[model samples]
Target: MTATMMTPAQLARFEARLLAERADAEERLAEFDGVMTEVRIARTDATADDEHDPEGPTMTQEWSQRSAVLADVRAELADVDRAIARIANGSYGVCTNCGKRITVARLDARPTAELCIDCARQAR
Candidate 1:
């Protein structure tokens, strides 16, 4: 049987989802950037008195958290970008594993997925 194709409306909905996610990631990344900038400036100023810097440990902890969060946000952004590209290339819903059409349910659940459920299960 021929694979079910995505309708224009469905594709629009998916696009909106990807774009919304991308915006959210961007927001988080910007927040992370702000935190990182403050941390960097605080750490590098060299004038922060060593006598009893109350912010030292706090800054260090925040830096570590920001780094980890940045990593996660970047990964999610990459996935969203890939999904947008797939949509543009007319390969959005096709499973990379078996060349089957991925169900709308799966795509809605994971817009960045490249593999179908069966293939993903086998790979796991």
Candidate 2:
């Protein structure tokens, strides 16, 4: 499959984006952790009258949702880390499956992608 090569400028942009995303993911994970802590505290403080607590269930549901979100962010963070490693190894933008240079557009859209569009679509 044919692949588009990224210029050094494009690679730089991708690196910047990855770094920003990594920071964002870390922030989000921290927020989730804080929310989970609140949920735990609420559950622990619940007493007899508060047993039918509406806030408790809501907090639990929110915690569950945040957990799922945290998982996704963690996965993306791992991908970004791998992409940074590839850049350090001079293999940035190269498709893992076909050894073709991944397009700048694709990298801009997904800076952590390891495969080109064709291989990615086919793999799916």
Candidate 3:
């Protein structure tokens, strides 16, 4: 049998999911930005006295955590953007690596996924 294509309803549903995911990622990114800003401010405000205080978390440590979280949020936002583009280009539910139809269940679970389950697992 020929690989089934995504129906209009499926496309619409995935579109909605991608859009919602994008919004959530954007919000998280903004939140992280605010937090990173705070961390930078605190880091800059640190004085010679704070250097000797071992009880408080070091600004370097806080900055590291904030940077890591921000990177993850940005990556998620990029994935959402790519997925939306794929939707527009008529290839949203197609596996990029295997060129096969991704199952509806997987698409429903991760509209931003770029590969089939097998490829994804292998990638990991």
Candidate 4:
């Protein structure tokens, strides 16, 4: 099936959105890094007994939660970087799976999406 290509204006808007997303992801990653550093320091503190405190979550739990979030943000940043590369290579808004045009609405919601909705749903 033939698919309509995005106009230059649409591409520009999507690129801007993706760049903003990248920045947000980077900011989250930095925050996570700082928190992880603090957690590491707390873990090594001689006076703290997070493992047996029973007052709140343990240091390990906090580290695990923050690590998971950090990983997610890193993945998002990678996706944004890839989307930017696709725009640079004239492949933005095109589904990699079926070589079809991804709908503008989908792109608006997920500028880093590489597959069209149908292919994405099928992949699940």
User: TM-scores for all candidates?
Assistant: 0.83, 0.80, 0.86, 0.87
Q: Rate the local accuracy (lDDT) of all candidates.
A: 0.86, 0.81, 0.82, 0.86
- Residue lDDT tens for model 1, 55-119: 77777888788899899999999999999998888888888878888889999899888888888
Query: How much does candidate 1 score in TM-score?
Result: 0.83
User: Which prediction has more favorable TM-score, 3 or 4?
Assistant: 4
* Candidate 3 lDDT over residue span 32-123, tens digit each: 88888887767656754476656347667877888988898898999999999998888887888988888889977787888989999999
What is candidate 4's lDDT per residue for 31-83, written digit by digit as tens?
A: 88898988887777723655455534665687788889888999999999999
lDDT of 2 at 34: 87
Better of 2 and 3 by TM-score: 3
lDDT assessment of candidate 3: 0.82
Predicted structure 2: lDDT: 0.81
lDDT of 4: 0.86
Can you tell me which runs of candidate 3 are displaced by over 4 Å?
A: 1-4, 47-57
Candidate 4 wrongly placed segments (more than 4 Å): 1-4, 46-57
Give the worst 10-residue stretch by lDDT in candidate 3: 47-56
Highest TM-score among the candidates is held by which one? Answer: 4
Each model's Cα RMSD: 2.6, 3.1, 2.6, 2.8
Report the lDDT of model 2 for residue 91. 88
The parts of candidate 2 lying over 4 Å away from their true place are 1-6, 47-56
